[model samples]
Structures are given as C-alpha cells and as structure tokens.
Target: MGRKAKHVLLTGGLVSGLGKGSVLAGIGRSLQDRGIVVNVIKIDPYLNEDAGGMSPAEHGEVFVLEGGEEVDQDFGVYERELELILSGKNNITTGKMWKRIREKERRGDYGGRTVQYFPDFVNEIEEWLSSVSQTTMTRKGIQPADVCLIELGGGLSSYEIDIYLEAFGRLRSKYGKENFLHIHLDVLVDVLGQFKTLPIQDSINRLKRKQLTPDLLLYRHKNEINSGAKVKLSETCMVENLFDIPFLENKEQLCGFLSKSGVVECISEQLKLELKSEKGLVAEWKRLHRLAPEPGKVVRIGIVAKYNINHDAYLSLTKAICDCARSLRYSVEITIIDAEQLEEGLEAAIAKLLIADGILVAGGFGVRGVNGKIMACKHAREKRIPYLGICLGMQVVVIEAARNLLGLYDATSTEFDPETANKIILKTENSKENQGGGSMCLGAKKSEILLEDSLAKKIYKNSFVIERHRHRYEMNVEYAEALKEKGVVVTMVDEKTRMPSFVEVRGHPFMVGTQSHPEFTSSIFTPSPIYCEFLKAALENKKCKTSMGLNTTNE
Candidate 1:
C-alpha cells in the first residue's frame, strides 16, 4: 500500500482579493521544484455548478480547461505558474457538492435516511478530496506523491467558510496533524502611516473559535512590516511562522519573492517535505524578469467585449497579450471598450477603435453585444488594422464578411437569428443538444492549417496544431466557396470534424480568427502565436503613427 498524501489548507482572513491565488501558486511551484508531485484544489462557496454562468464583473474570469470545464480564474494562475494541466475536478463548488448529494439521495444511495449537512455533506467533501487527489495521480502516471493543496474561497469569518473549517478539522483528525498544515492569509493596511494588526488579530481569534489554528500567517501589506509590528503579531497571533508578503509588480517575481521570504521553506517544513535548492528555478525567473520591456514604446490594443467592465473576465486573453508583448520587448497598453457602447453609435466606437494600434474582438455568448462586436470587427477589417477574433468573435468576422464582401445581407448565426440565412451554423453534434452550460464542444482538439501563405500558418509555423476550444458554433461549410470567391481565406480546419478552425483576410497586415482558444494554452514562457503576431503588427502600426506624427483623439 502507498503512503497517504499530505494536505495543506489555505484560507483568507480580514478580506478577500489579497492575492491568495498567486500565493498558492507560488507554494505549489516551490513544492514541484522539490521533486514533489503537487495537485491543487480550489473550493468555491458559490451555488453555481461552475464559473461559466457567473458574471465576470462580480466573480472575475472563467478559465476553461482543456477538458472544457469553465472554472475559476485561479485555475489559470495554477496552470501558468506550475506548468501543469488541471481539470474541472480541481475546482469544487458548493453547488456541485449539493448537486452530487441530492443525486445520491434521489437514487437512494443514502439508504432513505434524512440527508443531513453535518456528517453526510462533510464526509462527502473529504471523500471527494481524497478521490480527486488519487485520480490526478493515476492520470498523470507519476509516482504516488500525495501532496494536495486545497484553497478555500471567501473570508474566514463567513458562515460558508465555517462549514469548510469544520470539515477540514474533521479531515485533520482523520489524517493526523503531521499530515495536515493550515496557512492563513491576511491583509495589513497603513492607518495614518502606522501599521495596524488589529484586523488580523481579530481574524485569528475568530478562527480559533472555530477550532482552527493557523500554522503560518501570511500578511499582505503595502509597506514593510516593522520590528515592533512583527513582535505584536507574533505575541497576539501565537504563530511563530509570520511572514510579510508584499504585492508583486509582476508574475516573474512570485517564485523569487516566496523563496527569499522563507515562506516556501516554512511550508516545506510544516508539510514534512524535504527542501531542495531552487537555484535553477530562481535563475530562470530572474532571466525572464530581466527580459521585460523598458518604458517608452507602447502599442495600445483595444479589446471589444461585452464583459469589459471586469477585466478579470478576459484574464487569459489579457495575460496572453501581455506575455506576447513582453517577449517582443515592447510595452502594451490595453484599452477595453464595451461592445454595447458601439451599439449605441458607430462614431464613438470608431473613434475608440482608431486610437488603438490594433483591435481584438473577444469571444462571448448571447446576442446582447453581437451588433457592437460586429461593428468593431467591420471597422478593423476595412481599416486594415491588425485584428484577432476568438470563438464568437470569429463568428462575427464570418458574418461581417458574408454581409459586406459577399453581399449576403441576411447572413447570420442560428444562435442569434435562427430564421436568417445562417452563415455560421451549429455543428451537427451540438444541433440536438440544449443551449448553454457544458453542452457545447469543449476541451483540446487538433486542427490542420490549410493555407501556406496565411498569417496563422506563419505564426504557428506548422501544418497542424492542437488548441483548446469552448464554443458551440462553426463556420457554415456551404458559404466556404462564396467566402473564398471574395478575399476571405479559410486557413485551418479540424482533422476529425473538418470544422473550419481558422480564417484570415488576404492582403491585410494581420487579420486572423480562430474557433479554438489559443489564449487557454498561452503561458509566460510560451506566448500564444496568434497574440504574438497580432501584437507584432500592432507595434509596426504604432511605429508608423509615431513616424507620421499623427495624434489620434482616442489616445
């Protein structure tokens, strides 16, 4: 029999949005560096089955896994930092938990006893944690090194959080203290130039009331923790492992900062894991950090989307653009424009679009912002501005092409106008499936580049590629010949489904759209090719404007 895995529970106190996700990623990376196979699980207290239906404005971005699960944005952080592939199971929500329990009860799996929340619900959570950890280990085909890091969402004082604490305490007792470690994260603010510890002290007291004592206290502060404040925290909190964690300027500094502050070492010791030197990892991080672009040259890219209010909704897309810009040694300035604003009028939208060196139409659902996105796409296409479209954004490009170029005024997607001549048709596989939620085509799939002289093929530098997808529509094959008759080019198609995967405009500096989401696979180390090429073109556009000395009103 294999040794049981160790568990680390991280919970936030005082306030939320204290960079808990980043801190968790740093710890996971450090553990991975020490030859430890680590798996991370995120516990969200929301009633939603997944983050897919949540408003990006409120909950942030919904990260899509290769398996097509729309999860919390933190999963993207874990993937980017640890360079590991995660699945839908990594993100556990209260709604998912309740759904499972109710299903079991409906099927009489609970043996007709009244389903209670205490032992039954709590026991289900623990069993789920164990099952997911083992399942990930088996799937990865690696040696069984059971070290799972679970992050509980929301503030420590909330009732939702109390339930998790109760379950965690029970799990600790079942697994033994040596096998469990709890890390508490808190915020420190400067009140009139003096560091305050009262919030965290109160938070710790609240935690103790729930029978949970933190093994480590990670303080998120803007300034340095003075000696007097440190002593006060140590004495009041009764935690010797007190560490100050400042807000990082960039992702490159995460691993280095964690290592320097000895937080990684403290976690390693508490988890009973051997500490290995992170010299190699640190050096690589520093190398990349030094490669960041200097200030001055800025290429502004405008993102037109429905969820422009909350930038977190487009976290991966924004991150991909940043990563690509950094690699090219140019700073990128992003301008987010709500597509609904464009629907109000074209003059205002065009003014904003023209100021950008390039334009990107992001993927979205529903017909709420479709007209506005279509307007933005048309402006980018006609103006010869660098453009990249994704999913619904790509469908917008096809619809615009059919209407403007091919003279198909009635061209539309069945999703928005089921009665109109559908230029973007629903796939046969998805035709009978109900709309919305997880019913759409999801996960990683393969596509082959069909055009040799296309921007997508040039950026990819290959005939074939695999990209993550999360959409229900595809380019209508019936319009392929008509679109080809114009200047529109079908650049790529899926190997199995023969679905059009990529499209481009001939003679444009850079105009490309993809059914697959290249942003999902993008990382700091390896930027997505589509974004890279788009940013590169934007840089050239910026240079042209600088040389010509034309200052636009939007800038």
Candidate 2:
C-alpha cells in the first residue's frame, strides 16, 4: 500500500480576517517550489452550497472555477499564488456537506441505523477529505504525492468550528501525529502602547481545552514582534515553530518574505519530507516582482458596480487592472462608485466619472442599480472617456447605445422590463423554459473576433480567443444590424452559437464591452489583453491631459 498522505490543518484563533488565506497560499507555494505536490482545501462554515448566492458585502467575491463552481474569494488568492487550477472539491461548505448527508440518508446508505452527528456525519467529512486528497494526488497526470493543506473557516470558538475540530482530532488519531500537523494563526494587537499577547494565549488555551494542540503558532501583527514578546509566546504556547508575520505592503514583498522564511523548513521537517532546491522558483518570483511598474503617473479608473460596498466583489477585475498597469509600467488608482447611489442622481455620478481617465461597468445580477450603470455608460460615451463593460455591463452598454444614440428611448433589456418593446437583450431559450435552474450560461467558451479594426481585436491581436462567461441574457441578434448601423460595432461572436460576444462604439476612443469575463483568466504573471489595452488608453489619456496642461486632480 502507498504511504499515508500528510495533512496540514490551518485554523484561526484570536480573530477572523487575520490573513489566514494569504498565509496558506504562501505556504502552499513554498512547498510546491520544493517539488512538493500540494492540494489546498477551504472549509467554509457558511450554510450555502457556495458563495454564488451570497452578497459580496457579506462574504466578498465569489470566485468561479473553470468547472463553473462558485467559491469564496480565497480561491482566487490560492490560484494566483500557487499557480494551480482548483475545482469545486477544493471548497467544502457546511451547506454542501449537509446536503450530501441528507441525500445519502434518503438513499439508505446508513442501512436504517440512526444517523448521528458523530461517527456518521464526522465519518462522512473524513471520507470526503480522503477522497479529495486522493483525487488531487494524481490530478493532471502529476506524480502521486499525498500532501494536503486544509484551511478551516471562522475562529475556533464557533459551534460549527468545534464540530470541525472534533472531526480533525479523529483524523489526527487515525492518520498518526506525523501525518497531521496543526498550525494556529493569531493576531497581536497594540493595547496601551504595547503589543498584547494575552488574546492569543487565551485562544491557545481554548484550543488545548478542546484537545487540539497547535504544532506551530503564527503571530500576525502590524509591526515587528520584539524579542521579549517572541520569548514570551514560546514560553506560554510551548510551540517551537513560532512565526511573527507583519502585514506586507505588496505581493512581491510577501512572496520574497515567505520564500526566505524558515516556515517551509519547519513544516517539511515535521512531515518528514525531503526538500528540493527552490533556486529556480526564487528567480522566477523575483522576475515577476521586478515587473512592478514604477511610481510616477496615476491613472484613475472608476468602476461602477452595485456591490461597491465591498470592493472585493470585483476583486478579479481590480486585480486585472493592477496586473495590466504593472505590464504597461503605469501606475493606476481605482475608485469604486456605488451604482445604487448613482440612481438617485447622475450629477454626483458624472462628477465621479469625470475624474476618472477611464470608466468600467462591472457585472452583476438583478435590476436594482442597472439604470445607474446605463447612465454611467452614457456619461462615458458622451464624454469620450475610455470605457470597458463586462457581462451585464455589456448588456447595458448596448441598451444605452440603442436608446440614446439610436433614438430608441424605450430601449431596455427584457431582464429589466419584460414589457419593453425594444427587447435588445433577451433571455436565452433555456432560461425562458426554466426560470431558476441551468438558465444562465456559465464557464469558458470560445469566441472569434468579427471586426478587424475594433478595440477588442487590436487588444487580443487574435481572430479567435477563449474566455470564461457567466450570464443569462444576450444581445438579440435580430437588432444586430440596427445596432451596427447606429454606430455600435460587433467585435466578436461565440464560435459555436455565433452570439455577439464583444461590442464597441465605432468612433469612441476606447468604449468596449464583452459578453464573456476576461478578468477570470487574468493573473499576476499574465495580464488579460483587454485590461492591458484599457489601461494603456487611460495612460495615453493621462499623458494627453499633461501635454495639454489640463488640471489632473479630480477636485
């Protein structure tokens, strides 16, 4: 039989949002650099199948996997840092687990025995973890290496968290101490001008009482931990691998610090795994880090979205802009404008949009703030400011052009108004049949650029491209000719359905929209072409302003 897989369980102690996800991603990347095949799993305690239905303000961005599974935003960090493709299995929510258990119970998998939380529910979770580990071991034809890194959601004191820890204890006993290592992350805050460690001490005490002793204690602090504090932590916690991690300013610094830190060595030693030289990985990371753009000019781009309350809702979009700025050697400042507020009055929204070198309309569901998005698009068009729209944003752009430019004031998406005569945007046939399930188009699809001189075509420099999509409505093909005659250019179409995938204003400087999401594929190493072009246009606009001696400040 093959050797048992090694497990690294990471849990938060003192508080939430203690950079646990970032630390986990860093550790996973470090291990991978040492030729270790690592799989990362996040156990969210939320009672949702996934994060898709949750509001971004409550839970941040819902990262859509290539498999179309919507997961927490940490999956984005994991994918970016580790450079690995994760799936639905990588994310396990409380709702998903319970659903599976209930289904199995209905199928009589327990053989009429009374189903209980312990020994039944707990065993199910253990089995699920084992299955995920085994599947990940041989994923993508890689050599079978049993090293799984699991991150528990929320703090240790929650009722749901206690249940998870109980299962974790059972797994540790079953797999042996050598196969399982627990790393606890706690925060050190400044109190009375001194870095207090009592909160962490109390947290560790709570864990000990629950029979879960941490092998490593990671201290998150705003500033450096003094020698006295470090000694005190060691003496109190009795953890040899005590790490003090200060909040980093940027990804480059974080990667460099993690690579040099001895955290990876301690973990590898505890798991009894041989470490390989990371010289190549270190050089690659340095090269990426050096790609950071110089600080000089600031190109402000306003992103108008309904979920502006939480900037993380558009994390991928914002990150893509940052990546593009780095590649172009241009600095960018992103401002989130609330679309709901814009609906109250365009005066304030226009003021915000005027300050931006470029404007972006982000994707979202429902009709709450859609009119505001349309108004923002109109402002971008009339002002000739660079504009980029995504998904629902694309739909609104078409609607705006149809109404204002095409002289069809009644033009609106059927999604917003089912009774509107000009149904420029119509629901997909499947969506019409089933109002709830499998209606929306999801996942990756291929597209072909139809217009040679369009902005999208120039950005991609390819006649054909593949991008991920998540939307239910599409531009009506019957109005395609009408829209084109009205100065709206169709740049791309789906290779299979021939649906309009990209559109742009004919004479505008950079007004463009995409039915598919380009942000999902954007990464630190490779910025999406559309975003690269958009930022380039914004930089040019900024330069143009400077050349004209125009005041650049928003005020």
Q: After superposition on all CA atoms, what RMSD does each candidate show versus the true structure?
A: 2.6, 2.4
Worst 10 residues of 1 by lDDT: 134-143
**Regions more than 4 Å wrong, model 1:** 134-143, 294-297, 346-349, 422-428, 431-435, 546-555
Give the poorly placed runs of model 2, Cα more than 4 Å off.
135-143, 292-297, 346-348, 432-438, 551-555
**Which tens-of-lDDT digit does each residue in 1-555 have in candidate 1?**
777678889989856787888898887766776667788899998788998877777888878888889899998898877777888888889999999999999999989998988899898898888877753432356455558888998887667767777888777777766788889999887898799889999988887776678889998887766889889999999987888788778766866787677776777777678766553665564576567686655788999988866768899999898877877787888988879889988666667777999999999878888998988888888877788898888888899999899888888888788888554555546645564667677889899988887777789999999999888778888888888878788889999988898888888888888898899888777788888888888877777777778546223
Candidates in order have lDDT scores of 0.81, 0.82
Tens digit per residue, CA lDDT, model 2, 18-82: 87888888787778888888888899987878777778777788777777777888888887667
Pairs of colliding residues, candidate 1: none
